[model samples]
Structure formats: structure tokens, C-alpha cells
Target chain A: MSDAVVLGLDVGGSSVKYRLASATPSEGIPEALAQGTVSTPKHDPVAGLAAIARDVTALHRLVAVVVGIPGLVDEASGTVLRSANLPALDGLALGPALSAELEVPVGVINDGRAAAVAEARWGAGSRERDVFTLALGTGIAGSHIVDGRVVDGAHGIAGELGHVVVEPSGARCACGQRGCLETVIGAPALRRAWNRAGGHGSPKDLLSAYEAGDARAARIIERGAAALADAILTLLALVDPGVIVIGGGLASAPHRIVERAAALVAERATFHRVPAIVPAILGKWAGAVGAVSEARELAGCVVGASAG
Target chain B: MSDAVVLGLDVGGSSVKYRLASATPSEGIPEALAQGTVSTPKHDPVAGLAAIARDVTALHRLVAVVVGIPGLVDEASGTVLRSANLPALDGLALGPALSAELEVPVGVINDGRAAAVAEARWGAGSRERDVFTLALGTGIAGSHIVDGRVVDGAHGIAGELGHVVVEPSGARCACGQRGCLETVIGAPALRRAWNRAGGHGSPKDLLSAYEAGDARAARIIERGAAALADAILTLLALVDPGVIVIGGGLASAPHRIVERAAALVAERATFHRVPAIVPAILGKWAGAVGAVSEARELAGCVVGASAG
Candidate 1:
């Protein structure tokens, strides 16, 4: 038995996760030798990265490692340019630093892009060639996967779907833009939309209310779906992919939301080829799967590792 | 003079364009090819394809041939699933038919994606690792390029920027979706936007008036830029490319429009590294250049073709 193993790490605004696993090409299970999550160290990216490296190294013997960060990263350069949520990590040579600490080939990627890689290789998106992953987390950011390659634009930023404006003069986005889709569709957007719809409750409450036939809740959900659909439809018109994978916390929304969003998209999209909208299959382990997947690829494994 | 050449055809909704005598890759001239544009056959798409095949075969001696269609084309399967503008050509075996007709290797691609190929290789987008091309025509469409390859989603549809809704409830688009950016940002949108601003005139007239400092004209231009900028910024947050090349007729709008849009994006996009917004270097001929460039790639030249 080959004793080769790779360590995958997913770093987010709130937490950092790791998995030690063995993988091979054409396999999906990256047999996890160990797995765990920790509160991001110090909320400072550099400290956070160092802490993550230390923890993962301690857990297992790894042949290679990969990290997924939550900000603008130059995957080609292996650096984290900046992240508002994890400030201390800005301008850090994360890949090189980790490679030095762990004494193995290390890789870094955008969390969303990494998740897309996971999906493309081993998840629902495996069926299609071009897949756009919309991570409806605390904020809405996305990754566009074309030809099995994630789009890292000229400046290493390409899939900013959340920032696409859905309201010309609507809500003020954190980026200072008005009425971004992220403002209307992300978790915070859902909350605001619920509030605007005259509700005083969490997203779950509003969703439950909507499911129970409350017109106001229904209206909020409808509005959010419609806005998201508009964005998705536009994406369809631009890049008619076979399917769209909607992930993150928002994936918890009822099938009705996804259906309605798809309907809205089908209604506006003209080119006839509409992408099927589905929830991401990777679930909570998407980051871990993606991170290890990247490591394996860096190690010249053309196939996927099985999940533990 | 190694007079290597390829026949490039851009099959649009209303017409078919042909270019002949392209220069070799070593030669510096972007596409040293003579050109021709003839009305697409007045008959249906099947007949039109036959017509194109006849024409292409007539010119097969040139080297290779490539056609850019306006629909959902599965380049791998060589199937045209749906094309709203060219309904007659839907579901045809474009590559097989043309390849058989010309008795040579042929390539078929989406018009916008083809343009991105051209721009990425020979146009202004040459420097960026991942670049996006936004085409503002009778309707708006876009293409994404990553690692010098077109971003074809799982279904061969990836760069549908126009359909993205900048306004969720703004207006109904031809695709049946309301508030799509194309509904308000393309030429038709510009015309409608100009009219809504209290002017009954063509886009050219409105642009002239705006250029002359007419308040109404200026407002229209300003509003268009603002809306467009909102879209660009949002995209920036999704996929931070190094640069964005603006194409289509509307790009001819006053430079102020691009500047103002950039300003709006800078203000609002917070999460991702922003890229510079620049005018398209390849003009109307971008599609042709891109078509020829794709054909050149298929023909396997030593040096890659130019994109711009």
C-alpha cells in the first residue's frame, strides 16, 4: 500500500479546517487520516495561517499541503493580497511560508475557487464542463470554472458575482457600491430583505414563515430569489453552462427558493440553454476537499482523493 | 514571407463575414487576412450553414476555417443546441458539416468567446492571465479568458454578462427576464435610457448631444455609465481580473462614462482586488480576428496567434 498522504486546509473568516488524507487519480475519497476545525487564530491572517500550519503539521505525516484563504489571492504567485475579515494575512507569502514550515510542496487558492475545484472533480458539477459556484455565505462571492480551470482574472479576481449589481440604487454594499446582488441575496441581504418586508426574525424564522404561506415571508424570499435569478440568468446569457451549484449557508433555503430562482432565470435568459441550478454536493467539507484536491494536483495527481 | 493564412468567418444573426490571406504567427501583423462580409443566407440556418460550407470550401485552400455562431454551441460535441437569433441553425452539427464540407479541420465557437480568444492572444487583453471581454451590441454579451483559454462553462456557456440583472425590477428584457443589465445597458437600453431622459433620438444623436454638453444627454450618459460601472464593480468582486476590455458600440461613449463607471466600482467593490477598466483595442473586427485566431490555434501553429 502506498503511504502517500496530503493535507488540505480551508481558512475562512470565522474558522480554519484541516484534513489529512490519502488520494490517487480518478478517486474521490481522500481517505481522511484526521480532520478538525479551529477558531481562526487571532482573526489575524498571518497568525491564523501560522496557527493552521502548526496544527495540521502536528496532526499527521503529509506528503504535500494546500491552503484555501478567504481573500484576494494570487494563486499563480501563492500570496494572499488582502482580506477584510482576516486582516493580518494581507501581503503574506502564504504558500511559500507554509511550504517552508511543513517542508513540502504547498499550494494556496481562493476558498470559492477551491470549492469549485472540489465540485468539478468530485461533486454535482462533475457532470458539466463550465460550472459557476456561488458561495452564499455571510457575504456572496463566487467562482467561475471554465474548461476545468478556475478563472483567476488578470488581477487574480474573476468571479465576483456577489458584487454584480441587481439594484441600480438599492442597498449600499460593503464595497461602497449601491444595490449589489450580494446586498439583496446574501445572508445579510436576506435579513435586510426580511426586515424590509416587515419581519423581526432570523432568516430561519422568515423562511419558515414563508413556507407556511406567509405573504410577507413569501415576498421576501421571492424578491431574493428573483434578484439572484437575474444575476444567474445574466450569467447564463454570457456563459451558458450546463449547471449552477449554489452552496454555503443559503443552500439551506427550501427547494422553492432554488426553483423560483431557476424559474426567474429561465424567464429572462434568451439563448435557450439554461443551466440547471442545484445545491453544492460537497457540503461542509467542501473546503477540506478543495484544499486537499489542490494539494494533490500540485503533487501531479490527475485524479481525485476519496473522502474519509 | 511565409504567407500562412486561415479563413475566418463570423456568422452573425444578419450576416457572415470572411477574412482571407492572414499573415503567419511570426509576421507581427495581427491577422494579415483579406476580408469579406456577405448577408447570411436569407433562408433558414441549415441552408445558411450549407451556404457557409460552400463558401468556406471555396476558400479551403487558404489553410483552416473557423466559424463563430450566436447560440449555445457545444464545441466538444459540435452541436448547436439553441440559437435564438439564428433559430434556423439550432441543433445542427456545425463542426461536422463544415469540417466535411471543407474537408479540413475546423473549429466552431461562440462569438464572444471567440473574440476573447482573439483578444487574449492578439488584442489588448494579451498581458493579463485572465481577461474578460464585454460586447455591447444590439444586445450585450461577454466572454471570459483564463490561462489563455476561453472559459467555457460545463455546458459551453460561461460569459453571459449582459443577462446579469443590474436591476431586478427595472425592465423586461428580450430574454423575458426583467432588469437584466443588457435591458438597460446595451444599445437598445441606451436608446431607451436616452428616451426616458426626455429625448427622442438615435444613440448617435444622443451621444452627440451628450458630447456637446446637453444636460439631458449628459444625464443619460452618466446614468448609463453608473449602471455599467455597478455591474463591472460587482464582477470585479467575483473574479478580480487584471483588466477589463470594453467592446461594442456603446464603448464609443465618452471616456467619462468609463471613468465614472470605474469610480463607482472603486467605491463599492471592497472584497476583491479591482482591475482597470479599459476600452477594447480590437474594434468591430474583434470577432473576425478572434475567429481567425481560433482557427489558427486549431491548425497548430508553432507560435500562438495574437489576441486583442
Candidate 2:
């Protein structure tokens, strides 16, 4: 029974989330251990990680530890190649660093990929063999799940959907890419869009205005939907997953935004059956649940290694 | 040894190709049994299938058959739901039909998906865990291989990359959709592009001319490359496959066209490494080899079931 326990960690640009869970695929998310907060060491990610690790190690008998970070990670080599937000994470062997500190096997995954795993396992994509999960958080990201396995790129840096150029000469993204959908749809982008439109409000407020039929708010939601729809349609053509799970803070917008995005994707999908566009089921627990799932996966790898 | 042989069939809109191979993965491609042509069924469609059954029965024995067709195939149910090209195939239980005719179990798959399986197992993609095979033929189609398995959609209709819209209002496609990459990059579109450039040459002749530095041919190639690059860059954002196998007739273009297309895709990729673009080595035999691979997979399923 102790082997079923796992420590799952989701390290965001501004916050750190963790969950303790039973590692069995059928086991429900453990409720006994849960802790999270806005990471105070954003300026010094290693310090923040060390603090997080100190907290995580207190949980008894972890089967494995899993962490998802916002960056290009070479999982095979256990190196964080790059991330603008977490500068200290770059070049760090995150898995070994945390593993040494915690004295347990650790598995590292891309945050988007971890979210996709959560969705594929228990959310809208539960029944799908192929699934795409989109996270519209502070920045946009996506993960491709095929046949129940994440499509980790050859160099272990897959699912960088946020940086894809929708327009050749559009806005410049912080990633040094122009016309990226992230610039047009991410949370920061949403605020900028609202400010540019002369609409003074937060995204939630904008959603309320949009519900009240404010033309500017509606236009803002429409633009977000259109950008999301285009990317979804493009993904539909390639991945053709059964369901698309839209998560992150942006997805909490009014119903019209999700409806419009679904309609647009449906309209453009030709050769494939338009997949279901649904909100992710994990909600606030997505990162934590995903981390536990990652831990379970790593446990399997460990068992396989020991057997071999 | 004959008990190890299975018939592999690849059905297309206008033609049918086939292969005969042993049931084991290591049996590889049997050179002597590689046989194919445009599938011709004289008289009634049922009669045509009977004829194919007879030909296949005459050539192989003792293992299940695998068929890859251009349509929406439910592999579990052994049904072809909607097929634009083969009206005779719609609503048909292809597996039962072939099983009844040949007295053997059969597995059916989408041709595009089967092509990816072939590549992942034995062709250009064998080296990578995540690879994509795109066939730019009469239609622009693709299949993804992630961790050595095809990501069959929940409904078995994933990998419809051609149907994804590159332009919201670009061109009408045969699937009753507008702006599909197929409408802009397929063979007919490429031919029209060549014609629009006032080049009175076949695809072959145009390739030679481009190799020899013909301005008109170069322009046409450039246009095709742009469309293809746009579609590829978009897909890269979603799947982030390590390698993309460019197959089918259009890939026959001289090295320059391929290089140009690669450069365009690379230029558009963001943050992540752009996938390596290369021609499929299996050429016309890809579908046949894929069919054989599918047959082996199906036979394995049967053996596994019997064992269980």
C-alpha cells in the first residue's frame, strides 16, 4: 500500500502546486496531503525549488516524485534547456537535483504535457486514444497524447504550441517569435487586448461585460476564440484526437467564448470528424493530479528498470 | 511457413494495391510477394471484392489479412462509415466481407494511418519515437507515430491533416470544406499552380525543369513549398514529432524543392527544434509495406486473443 503513494509537483512561473496520491491507475486522487502557494523565489527558482523540495519531502513514503516546469526540458538528459520566466532553471538537472534532495526517484515533464496526461487519464479525454490538451494560462501551451502516451519530441521538447506563428507579420511574442497565438490569447495578452480596445476590465470582468452583450468585450472574446479555433482546427487536421480539453484560467471565460471556439473548429474540420471541445475536468487540481500521474509513470519505469 | 503469410491490401480512391507477407514483424518485406496495381473490380462491386479475395486466397494462407483504405474506418467494429472516394465501401463491414470471402480474420485501417505505422516500424521514422508520415498525393494526408503506435482517434479517424484549413477562405476542397491544405497542396492543386505559372509541363517535366533552374517551375515549386511549410509549421506546434516523412509523387521533386520547403518550415517554427523533413524511402511501396505491417499486427491480436 505504501508503494501506491506518490508526490506530484507542478512548478509554474509564479506558483508551486503539489499533491500526494496513490500511484495505482485506478486509485483516486489522495486527499490526505495537499499544499500550494505563489512561489516566493520566482527571482531565484533554485531557492524556490529547494524550499518546495523541503516541503515535499515531509510527506511519508513517496513511491516517486514528479515535477512539471515551464521550459524546454531535455527529459532524457534531465536538463532544463531554457525558460524566460524561470531563468535559474536553465541548464539545471532538475530531476537529479530534486531527487538528491528528496532521496527518491523523480520524473520531470513539461507542464503542458503533464496537464495533457491529467486530462487523458481522468478529464474530458478519458476515453480518447489520441488527445490534445490546451492550457491558456499566463502563456499558451499544448500537449499531444497519442495512444495514451505523450508525444515527447525527439529531444524531449515537444508541445511548444504557444509559439506557433498564426500570422507572419503580427505581434512579437516574448519568445522572440512574431505572430504567435500566445501573444493574442494568453492571459497577459487578454489584458493587453482589453486595454487596447478601450475596455477597462480584468478578464473575468470582461467576461461579465461580454455576457451583458458589450460589443468590445464580445469582440475581444471573438478574437481569442478565433485564434484558438484556428489552432484547434490545425490540430484537428494533424492529431485528429477524439476530444480537445481547454484548461488554464482563460478557459473559465463566459460560455460564448467556448461555444464560438468550438463552432469555428467544427466549421474548419473537413476530412476528420470534429472532436468534442470541452472544458478540462481537473480544474484547480489539474497540475497536482498530473504530477501524481507522472509519478506513477516514473514508478513504472523504475520497476521496469529493476526487473531488467 | 505458408501459415505465417498474410495478405496486405491498400485501397485508395481510384486504385487498390496489395502485398503478401509473413505474420512476424521480423519477417520483413518479402520481395517476391510484393504485388500491386490500381484495384480493378469488374461488374458489381461485390464481385470485384470476391475477385480480390480469390486472388489473395490463391497467394497466401494461414494468417489474418489487413486492409488500409481511404475512408473513416472503425477498426474495432470493422466498418467503413463514410468514404468520399469509394461509395461502394460506405456502410460495409469490410472485415466480415473479407473474412467470409477468404475464411480468415481481417484488420482494417485508415491508409494514412497505416502509412505511419509502416514508417515507424521499418522506414524513415524507425529511428525516432515520435514521427509523422505525410503523403502529398491526389490528396494531402498524414499519419502520426508516437512511441511506436498510431494514434487512432477514439472513433478511428485521426490524422486527417489534409482537411485542416490553411486559409479560412482560400479554396474549395472535395470534402465540402474550404481552404483545406489538400485544396491548396494536393496534386491537382500543384498542377494548377504549374499551369498558373504558364508552365506547359507535367509534374515530372516540371521537376526536371526546376532542377535545371527554370524560373516558372521554381515559382510553382516555391508556391507549393510555402503552402506545405505553413501547414507543417502549424502541425509542428501541435504534435512536435521528431521527423516528418514527405512521401507520394510530389516528393519526387529535385533536392532543391525539398531543401526550400525545409527552410520555410524551419523559419516558421518557434522555440522548439523544427522537425527534419525527408523523403519517404518506401516510395510507391509504402502503402504495401504498411498493409503488411497492419496484417502482422492483426494476426498478433488474433493470436493474443486465442492465447488469452
Candidate 3:
């Protein structure tokens, strides 16, 4: 069954990214035999599966498929309890429905958790026993890989690291919490805070202003950095992961946030052995690769292999 | 071996609280066959083990023993990596040393985690799949019981939840962090904050003062409560335990803290199904009971049983 491979799909609101790889890739996350994206087919799970099936025609022997979506996933029933992005996907028995259509077992996972597992196993973490990955963008997404397994809370998603209140008097979040980490450090929040502080500049210019010792810009950057540091500290208090992988939509400027966060952690940590704070290597492909890895786990019936 | 029993010891700085119980408890942590406390022997791990061995002589058909200490524990080596209270116990191979003296399988665990395990399985958590227990004392102790197992970090302890920064310009923590949860809400810190706010009263008086409409007292109570609510929120974001058990060093007035914390959680939560905020029923016996439970896990070889 050398030609046998599994399909991994990272289902997003706008597009569907797919990875077709061997059930047991020799190296960690080898280049997929087949990969790419297509516009997401919305409205119903069945229509979505048909669109994917039509595009996924020329793949090798497909043994199984695992799909990652942004939501609270009930893996047992193979349904998305909720998805802020793909509301249409919610409450659909996508696993059973997709499995029936694809003629292979299908698995569902949170996209954030999928990325976390990929980074923990093969991306930036180098196969550490535990890892915490954060996707810092318009909103923040978080998940922990504990003992090499992604952990979700009682409600199927241990999500919203950004919801932690940082400033009791700061901007209100859509989640209705005021002064959340998101309000203090989210990319848009950073830009807004800069504007509120009288800096009429672009997001990229704020990075330059901070580097060039602009006092107002410095304070604004510090607030976000401090919030990120506090989040890091909170994660350390709870899970104590061996490594923390940082990635997502926030480009260039976020490196300074990461650097400051590392410094704050070093300055504040007494009992903690600070783990390597590294950038995610998988980048945009994390969710799809993670889906493949999880699929391999399910299909590879060897001593440690799983079948998704 | 219905007659066989296990010795569970909670080794603290000043006392060793113990319980002798059957491996197969008929119910969730029945009253121990024998239970009590003795002054701790200091200066050496051997002497400590000897004292415990001597007191444990009257127990019946001992199959195993497990000890809980306030420190980072290397369970495999049966050693306390470090303990703030019993400094001499640090780095000592207590498990191997005790096993040699008692001729029984011995295990070592962090006292906080031990209590968490007990509370999750046989105490307030009511055997929930996920439980997060916080021992609110001079130092806040915390642990998560996920899928019925106590989780520690890479270095044997996922500790220092109190170290999470809550205030940037607030009091300095002994751990060298500013505005940690401990600085805002630890028993001693609460007393100091109350005193610093010009309240010339005892710890118990602060509770009544807040009840009597004292603004300063209210703020003091609110700060502690808000800090706790943030910690609770952080836990929800990470592990999403089904229940949260609160108990420990802060007594009497702390009920108000719990009440305020619950209110804040309810007000702030948009999607989180607020977990049951309950008091720990096992109280002082949690660590000892947890040790016994862990011992049972070690000796019992059923599907869900573990030898830890």
C-alpha cells in the first residue's frame, strides 16, 4: 500500500486547503503528494463535501480524511457545535455525512488545535511532549498540545486566550469583556490604540516609530507586549509547555511583541524553566499538515499509529 | 486482597497527615480505616521516612504507600526535586528510600496536585471528566484533573498560578513579579492591603467591614475577587474543567471572594458555560485522600486504573 495516502483538509470560511500524504510519512510532515486550495462551498455540509470531492479526484489511494474547521467540535458525533466563521457548518453531522460521501472514515478537529498539534510534532517545537501555539491576528486562537495530544476544554474548545482581561478600563470586545488581551494586543487593537494615542500612522509605521524611540508609540507597544507576556505567564502557570510556537496574521511588528514577551518572561520567571519561544515553521499550512498527522495517527495501525 | 490497605501520607512542613485505606474503596473515598497526624521529622529524608515507617507499623496488610509533598516531584525517581517547606527533602530519593524501609511500592506527588486529584475524583468535583481545584492559602496552589488524571508540567509541576501578573503598577511579589495574583489575593497580602487602606482591623474584621458598606473594604474585597475571576477565566481558556473547587488558607470572609468571583464570571462570560463553583468537601483530608486514590490507581489494574 505504498501508494495509499490520506486526505487532510483545513476548511476555512473563505477557502479550503487540502493535503494528500502517506498514512505514514517517513519524515515529519513531508511535502504532500497533492495540495492546494479551492473556494469554500458553503450553505450545507453535503454541498461542501461534493465540491471537495470534485476537486480531490486525482489523489492516490485515499484511506481516510480528517478536516479541521474553526469551531467547537464534538468529535464523538462528528459535528461542529459552533463556528464563528462557518455558521453554516454548525450542528451539521459533517463527519458521518462526509464519511458517507467520501467512502472513508472522517474526523473533525478545531483548526487552532490542528495547527497546535502540527507545530508541536513537526514544526517549531521539534516533537516536544507539550506545546502551546497562538495564532495572533484580528482575533487570537490558542490550543495546547499536552503529552503530544491536543487538549480542549469541557465544551470542545479550550479557546479564546485573547478573552483574558488585561485592562479593566480598555476597549470592549465583541465577546463583551472589557480590557481583554485582544483589546490590548490584537492587530486591529494595536492600530486603534496607536491612533487613539495621537499617532496618525499606518500599522507598519507604528513598528518603525517604536523602533525609533517614539514615546507615545513605545507606550502603546509596551501595553500589547505586557499583555502578551501576561498571557505567556498564564500559560506557564497552567500547562508549562516545553515550547510555545507563535504565528498567524500579525507580521513583522509582532516580532517585537514576541521579543518583549520573552524579555518579560525572563524578568518575571523565578521557578519556571522558560521554554524556547519560537516562530511556527508550518505557517499557513499548519492546520492542513496537522490534519494529515492526525489522519496518520488514525490510519497507521502500528504500535503508536492512529487511524484519525 | 480485600484485607490489603495502602498508606497515604500528606507531608507538609510541620506535620505529616496520613490515611490508611483499602485498595478498592467501596465508595468514593470512604473514611480511612485509620487517620491522624504527627509532627514532621526534619533535616533528612531518611529520618522523615523512618518516622513515617514507625507510625505506620500498625496498618494492615499494606500493599503500597504514596506520599504527597509541597514541591516539584520526580515521580519516576520518587524524589522531591525541590520543596519550599521541607528544604532538606529536596533532591532526596524519598520513594526508593521509603520503599526499601517499608517493602512496598512507593510513589511521590506534589501536595497541590494530590489535593486536586482527590477533589476531582472523590470530593466536590463529583468525578467530573475535567476538574480544576485551587487551594487558596498563603500561596495559591492549583492543579487540573483532565480525563481523570492530574497534569503537571515538563519539570514535574505546572505550578505558580498565583504568579500570573494581575497589576502592572501594583505590589511586588516575592517571586520578583509585579502584581501577581498572589500579591493581590493571598491571605497575607489581603490582610496587608486592608491594613494599607487605613483599616485598623483584623483579617476577620475586613469581611464584616465590607458587609457594613465600607468602600475601602469593598475595593479590597473586589480586587481580590476580580483577581480570582481572572484566574478562573484563564483556567477556562486553557483546560475548561467541568468544575472548579476553591478551598484553602484564606478562611471566613473568603466566601465573599468566591461569591464575587462567581458573579464576575457570570457577567463576563458570553459563551463559556460557567462551571460549578463549589467548595471542597474533603477539606483538610484532600491531600491524604488523593494520595490514597493514587495508590489505588497504582495497585488496581483495571481498564482505567493506573499505578501512579
- Tens digits of lDDT, candidate 3, A200-265: 766567778888899998887787788888777777777787888888877424567778888988
Query: What is the number of backbone collisions in each predicted candidate, taken in the order shown?
Result: 62, 2, 10
Expressed as tens digits, the lDDT of each residue in B54-114 for candidate 3 is: 5774646677788999987888889888899898888889998888887778889888788
> What would the per-residue lDDT of candidate 1 be over residues A1-308, giving only the tens digit for each residue?
34567878888777788887764544555667788898877544555565666665564445677888877787777898877777777888888877776677778888777888787667878877777777776787667775566755655555667776677668888877677777877777787778877888777778788888999988887878877876776566555667788877867565566678888766656654877788888788888888887787776642233332
Model 2, C-alpha of A292: deviation from truth (Å)? 2.3
Candidate 3's iRMSD: 1.9
Give residue A227's lDDT in candidate 2 (0 to 100). 80
DockQ each: 0.49, 0.52, 0.53
- Report the number of the highest-TM-score candidate: 3
Candidate 3 DockQ category? Answer: medium
Using lDDT as the measure, name the better of candidate 1 and candidate 3: 3
User: DockQ rank, highest first?
Assistant: 3, 2, 1
Q: What is the total number of backbone clashes in candidate 1?
A: 62
**Candidates 1 and 2, the one with greater TM-score:** 2
| TM-scores for every predicted model | 0.77, 0.86, 0.87
